[model samples]
Target chain A: MFDIRSSIINQKKYKVFYAIIPFLALFIALFIGGVLIFFAGINPWKAYNYMLQSIFGNIRLFSEVFTHFVPLVFCALSFAVAYKGGFFNVGGEGQLYFGALTATLAGVYIQGLPAFIHIPLVLLTGFIGGAFWCWIAGILKIKLGADEILNTIMLSYLAILLINFVVMYFLKPANSYISQSEKIAKSAYFPKLIPHTQINLGVILSLLTVIIIYYFLYRSPYGYQIRAIGENSDAANYAGMNILKGTMTVIIISGGLAGLAGASMLMGTQYRLTPAFSPGYGFEGIGAAVMARNNPWGIILTAFLFALLRVGAGAMQRGVGVPLPISWTIEGIIMILITGSEYLSNKFSTNLIGGRA
Target chain B: MKKSKVFLRVFVLAFAILMIFSTLAMTAPLKIAIILPHAITSEGWTKSGFDGLMKAKEDFDIETSYQENVSEGELKGALRGYIAEGYDLIIVHEMGYNDPTLEVAEESPDTMFAITYGFKAADNVAVTSGTNWQANSLAGAVAGLMTKSNKVGFIISNDSPVAHNFLNAGFIYGAKRINPKAEVITTFVGSWSDVVKGKELAKAMIKQGVDVIYSQCGVVNRAVIEVCEEAGIWAIGAVEDMSYVAPQTVIANALAPTEYLVYGVIKEMVEGTLKGGRVVKGIKDGAEEITFNPLLKDKLPENGEEKIMKLRQEIVDGDITLEQMQEELNKQNIKF
Candidate 1:
């Protein structure tokens, strides 16, 4: 009745449970938000209606939601790529900033190119910039046995400061009235997808990136080896897999993804280098990646969920006269619930399968 | 005998002119230097200061040099560098640089120091600024005359006395003068850049029947204008002309031209009347002025121009004073 291979896991039951998890998480999150809404002296139904209507009812606002969605998905993909190879890349923020810096430099300095060449050139440099940041952490982790988490966290702040210091002096516009760089060349800007909305080529690129990463993680031999090492490094090593190369490649890809996020933001709406450009998209990416269970396709949905919270935050303020921090409460509840559920599920699986109970 | 005497007199006059020219060459033009917090173009605030420095150079014929992007931490060092360079008049053309400016000024007491947008002063330091009171008072006067609802609103970033004394008090005084029953509903949105909060607060005021509102929160000014545009109401803009931002909604703009403050301080220095005190000037000194929306020019009530011109004249003539408004506010228990 309890054969190890056959009954170790009930596939059908697990599939059903897995399918229900997101809905359950969503329900629980909304419930917590509802309770807070009640305390804020606003009707929960009206508040939720306002949140949804603010984004969906207006085409312009809906496009803005995608603008937020692009960065979240890229960041999530960045985290997911490294995490799939048994590495935790926490420096997406730094990498993203570095990418933005390089993109801005290219956009502002590298002149005399047509739109086609310039956009790609700027975006490529951004990816390289991010990859360069990631490569240092990867080398430190693999070659020198350093903690990537700490290295990335520290380096992220360095990247932000580096951009600020550079822009404050050498890169500053001749007649700039603010502490920011000159606007990037018009040709280097991302093509607009909608006339009035902020939706740009970044959204299309993000979707394509998701598909490409999904294939890279599932189809290629390198992908299999990376996942194998993630599952059991010793086992993979005994099977003649190159753990060093696999891990490094994962990190570079992760960094590139994050860098793309930075480049997109710069080329899309911002058009220049400013310190306040990123609103913790780097950290939020990690959250989205974890929420998606590192699944490439699931990341899109998770990113949209977070975007919903952000885009709706303003409407919540405008509609019910509730403070914007109400969104933060819902975000906190969702994070805790997702983390708690994952912890409980792992233990449940361990007891059931590991113990053969 | 007459020809010889004439030649002698001409020779003596030529020699005297040569001596005067050589003596003038020995002295140099006034060496004035300015330190700004930003580059001179694009943004309006720092540009005004830079423009003032340029104008001072042209008007007073002073030698001028400038350093931009000198942060607060670097302000003392920058000021010291100017002192070492033997600049006659040194100016920190930005707000919130008082402490370091005064510290550097005290170290070199003989050197004159000037800072913009502060109330502090010392023997070697002069605080030159445009008064926020008059610009806002003028906006209030317009709102009071224009509002059909008898309720004007004043939305600010925070509860600073600087704002309460100048923006709120001055606004209330002007509005009450036009319509004594007019209520000034003031709200603080906590931060200047919180556009969402700005719009929501503006909407809340609109719900309370505030037809004409004054927005003084820097970037949130756009949000307030947007709310007014959405509600088809009137809004008075601050700091810069915002008719371009919301053509249909922005009725008038309160201006803070820093060039006036800069030019005035430099003139004082050149005239040897540069006293160490807060020299806050408005309207008359060209520091602040209330400008009507050119786009909505026809929307103005008949005699609105005459009425505004008279108020401005009174303000310029010292008949309508900020001190009087401050006393009025104090009388009404409106201190911080």
Candidate 2:
């Protein structure tokens, strides 16, 4: 049981095992997905073909996939950062709604500024709004010893209601039939990267965020302390690392990342805030982060993979006869497999790396 | 090594087979795709849309498909997916799809887009509304005449001022026309499928002396009908002939001629007669009507069905106007 020397040596051998797990897990998930398609009375081969053709066959379709992928990357990284600091950050959805609401308000009323000045101002306001919403849970956890999970979950409900109220009464366009705010000012719009496609400046910003987060998490001293706190908060406290301050910093950064996702949708694609604008992207971000094992670089791959499945799902329905619910079923099965693999890897690693059985 | 070899072989084989099928799909007939915000299997609103699409598919001999449970966020992606697949006609079956439909229609001008309950239109977009207000007016008139309490209830799912304000105002107007002393009470459950809440709201209205309830509560309308049926209060149905849901309780059901409207649109498209603009079909155009439940016909007030039918025909003939109804409400100081 006291084999610290052997465990240290076994760490080198375990790197190869860790590297292969995600690919193996994804393959297993897709294989199960194939079985499900076969059971649905359609040839699994045809369905896969339809999905592939719809996603990659045309420039416009691929651009649409890219448009959806940008927000997922920001959202996944947000969750990944929070997870790195041992905070669950279940309030991402609420934070996202608040971000969108603030961004929409700023975009609608803040006028007569140049695009260079106006766009950043609106996005920064959105980030601040999201950070403030999550800061409530942070303060609650630190001061009252309240559960951040419950606080974040409840905050999400409040955020949704808040946005709905604002859109219904205040921001709503006069005489407009739908419950959506007026379009953002022209100066605040994210310039489209591709004509006639929704791909916009958010894609470039998301890439920059991924790189910055990677550098912050892996190459910075603060990042080391946060990782240490995540591993063992009591040990980190004994080492003179301020756990509470570290938690506060990471959760706020995580919230800001999710807020950027809201900005991406508001500026990049939607250009106005509408009801149900997120459609669970914030929650799905948690799924993407989990599949990536909270690695910033891995999040990019996983987010694109999820976007591929989503963009192809609609095509699967029209090109073939598979119901829309089956698309969600496929995603659910894959997420289950990824989580299962994560559990299995952790279980086997403790034994293989010279820990007590 | 052996497992890798087998996996590679299977992958290659699957890829080869997929290519063959992709080529075959390119040669299929003109495809039509409909995107629904709710599940297609639901018995009320989505079901009507599904029935209409199926009827169009059969009548025109064109290939039609639908993606259900789509959210507003996913609307643009779903529409573009259909457009990318070379679909000739795209049917967005919800009002929230308005802006997205317009955006996609502008991007792909050749593809014909039809939207239900949509207000705005573009060069290639056609907006069709069911105009269920006429049927609600008739149902309101019947409630006005039959209510002993002189107070009727209107329960709506959500409070979208534009989509519903007219129907609610119409109900009040119709009620006032027959019984000048009648009063209308309105309640919103804030959700479409909350049966418990619907029942609670309906019960409260019944206690307040609401003898009749005109419900636009979607699937949860059953809950309102259940409460009404138990308390011996009258109820009117919505969107379809929901009399079978509670045969003994429902007095009249508002029939939105969804199938006729959808099939008629498709027929026009095939005959090259469809154009882009707003197409509103009401009682006169046979797009909407009210059907009294035959089982409860005797329980209703004498000459009630006859008078409702006369009013319905008068609406069709433009004898009674929405303005006149609004004026009547104003005169009585009734707020819808």
Candidate 3:
């Protein structure tokens, strides 16, 4: 009994060490990025200074950062939820498109509804659209023995074409040159969080989602079942945890979260559905999930960091003369370092624990 | 006490000098920045814009910079970054940038924003597009006259019908004018970079007896032209002089003079003649031109170039209205 208790304590220490790896990895990535910038004959300090300013200098710029952040938070949580159950849900992009398209259709067609009813109804429609699309992949994977990864990726392209066709033929506004649906009713739009800024209720929704996801993943018994399946599905099945139910539930929830990102984007800022509006936000969410090491709180920080990089990259080009490609290079380096650190730390922890045992 | 008094006097002089110099800096040559969806090295819209910006920088003695491969989601942030960096003008080099450009323009009233291939403008933003129809009509006439099969193919990079209506309709009109029985088969590849798709579509159209292709894709146009080369058919270029890639297969280019448009706008900005509004430059403004490949100089059918040049003149003289072309598109029910 004492030995088992000691082993449990050691496992807690291992968890703490794993928690610090992401930050350490991030530090190394930034350091390498600084070195690359230095070799290019610019002051890395000036580059970072510009990024910091865009993120926190003024209320407006800060709000812009959040505008980028809101969609990303939803996407990361989408990927993270499925990831926790050992499912690679690569359908975030497709799910986001469906969500936004459905929300736009709801916002444009459904008239005379009150603001309270209309907004939630639009959001719920978006969630259903994304969930339904993802559910197709889930059903295929479960019933037909298809790979979810390949099915999800393929569905993303179909979703893009579907949205394009709908916008071009069905929802296109007359007298408008671009292929986009008409603007939603004012009542359907998310109320701005800060007057005169793009920051909207979507920001609050994302935050609430983060907390709710945390509780679902860590505090709930269902979360425990998911983790058990993730660690070892065969063992989990042997322990009588219904693997099939867990997989379907996590995938549906994951797709729904990503769909919410589409809602936040259309309702909060775009206010109209345009093809390519999601613009790879779903893929970027996967990057965020990887950077956060699949931790919900970590995803928030990583998503904000990506926003800062995006906004600051332009400034770096304008102010410091760093080419736009260099910014992407930095982003790639950072992600590689983060994932690499996570791998090495896990290996080291495992070896250390084995030796001590 | 004496040393402190001297230090105060020096500090005051320094502050006054700094204020005077900063004011001069603001009134100096305007700083310009451009954001593009693709690399400048690509032989298409981005290249022409980059070349124009460079020429304007030289002619006007202005400072300039650019960021490439900026997506729609990142556009607002890029514009804001340029504004925060004190750039006087920002040129968005794609149509997809219209909404983002306008959003940033409203937020930063002091910064002047210019967009190529956009139709909307504000007090602080200017939108401009090259005449897609003028040169395309001329090129289409050439294709119609040259085709032995009386069938021609049209491929575009999936711009909205509202945006490319003139080009699409004008091609049909110019072709049907010469050969009323000419069957114009149109296809949208949905992307500028999908070379494989472009090639496959061109092949399918060729199998359908399309002997000439009016290609409007970006990098993917090369694939279309290559397919033409293999099949020993003729192809027309869009926006850029693509004859350099395959002189044997390409006959004439329907030029959308993006460089001329961008250069004219930047020059106006330097001279303080630039204003916020839509400036739709077409054949009259020399915003559209076509270059015949010298390799195909001897292969011209009787009056092919003559007919195309005549139509070009008519377009420039305003004898042919965009409304007329749009009507043709409507009659054919061409989907955007």
Candidate 4:
């Protein structure tokens, strides 16, 4: 049997190789993207330059990119924590919706509270709501041997339906015509960091979250046990680690992080909950987490890149008359290339080491 | 080793050069961008707006482009790009774009921006929305007059102000106008284009004794119509003369002609008659109107055609204002 676990964790050379994998993957993806441009009746080089200029050419565009990066970081961190404990938490999107929904409710209902108390309380509601949602999935998995992926996906749909029901039946504002929750109180809002831009303190909080999660993952004792369980459940069991407990803890933490992401949208950006408030941040978080291989710092970098691409794609659509769907195509191609590069690098390393042996 | 290094360096350099050239080639003339909330292929509701822009482009003689499936985070970048490229007008559809549109408008004061919904206006921003509720009320009144079962159904998408104020409220109010005893059963699918759910809800309503359905849920209207057709019941259409979408079952339609609004705005812009503020287009402005199916035209109630035509004239003549219409409906205990 292949010693995959040892190869992944114990090898210093493999660590260095994996460290460069993401960049190599991106480089290769861009090259493949060039060919796609050629087929689209556009020169690949010019398309990429336009894309780059749209993202990083000006302060306004850069701000737009980073603004998107804020929520993505939170979402990625959410997934990274669950992934670290060998649990696939796909309910991030639903958890995010519940988080925003609960936060919005708290913000609207709880009045007369000071800004400091209201803001933290609203955000805490989101964290608790998301964690509670994830805990359900974890509990079901542990108690009933239910598949986390299927249950989480179903829960996400349920969460969406539940939010719709709440918004329509309870949270809708007076005289409002739509199915949206009432706007949160002014005191509950996240303060803007920039004068004219939508960029808020949430970006700073997300970055802080990354640092905190990184510390919790690598520098803390609990992190060690989680990693150990993730590496091998049988070995972890032999070593006196409770696999069920670790999975539950990680899922809750993951869901909490994702919920915080949703809260950030309510507090920092939207200031209200609508049916379409989230633009699939949960799915994007998965991409970001996978791209970074669940590393906290790596997730930040990947999330930023994803944000840059998203922001730049918008610019491309506006400036160059390129359709928005083309951007999705570019993203899809990049993801494929990234996966291909990883496979290629692994094969190359195997051959080189085999020859040496 | 030197040869391999040289090859790699040259390849990288060539790739960089290609990237630079591709970026330059993408620059276009007279860039006009639109940011839409949903995918273009989603049909009817969003596509109609895109179609209106495409129609406007024919007369305006400008380069038009649109971004579909745009979320709040992407709106700023899309707007910034158009502004940077010296685009004259950037039209954003969907209410969610309100805050982002305001932010982008403030950021780029030079760019002329237009938003489809909402009354909030800035110096550089122009707000345009129709009296959708007025049209929807008309359709509801028609449903009230036409339904034989005394039970009418309404399929709503989301419980947004846009839907409730214009479509749902108007529908209920209209139904009650002609028949006070009529029961209006309302169900919301929670999505703008969920045909499956829409069909399910409509079927459920029909099963509960609803004979006529006023679909106020955009693309999901098709599903409601489908259910109506299958059940062989009467259904009212809104937003466009969606009577054509399900001709056999659709009895009438309340039209919110977005193209008319887009054309009117562009024409004003061309004539230098456009200004910054909200423009509320309604029946009086020929923005909202009702279209009855040809099959049902002669079959309407004895004086129904004359009554509706007289009401249209009264609305156009300003003898019956939207406020007056609301008051009249309110006297009837209709909440539209």
Higher-TM-score candidate of 3 and 4: 3
- Candidate 3 chain A: worst-modelled 10 consecutive residues by lDDT: A348-357
CAPRI quality level assigned to candidate 4 from its DockQ score: acceptable
lDDT values for all models: 0.80, 0.83, 0.84, 0.77
Query: In model 3, where do residues sit more than 4 Å from their true spots?
Result: A1-16, A35-45, A232-243, A355-357, B328-336
Better of 3 and 4 by lDDT: 3
The i-RMS of candidate 1 is: 19.8
Assign candidate 2 its CAPRI class: medium
Better of 1 and 3 by lDDT: 3
Clashing pairs in 3: none
lDDT of 1 at B245: 79
Docking class of 3: medium
Cα lDDT of candidate 1 equals 0.80
Q: Which stretches in model 1 have alpha-carbon errors above 4 Å? A: A1-9, A354-357, B1-336
For TM-score, the strongest prediction is: 3
**DockQ score of each predicted structure, in the order shown:** 0.01, 0.58, 0.56, 0.37
Go through the candidates in order and give the clash count of each.
0, 0, 0, 18
Q: Return whichever of 2 and 3 wins on DockQ.
A: 2
Q: What are the per-candidate TM-scores when only chain A is compared?
A: 0.95, 0.93, 0.92, 0.90
Window of ten residues with lowest summed lDDT in model 1 chain A: A314-323
* Candidate 3 residue lDDT tens string, B1-336: 999999999999999999999999877778998888877766677788889989888888798989887776667767766776788889999876677678778888998989988978999998888766777787778888888999999998885765367667778888887777788888888987888999999999999999999888778788899999999999988888889888898998888868888898898888888899998888777788877998898898877778878887888888888787777667877542
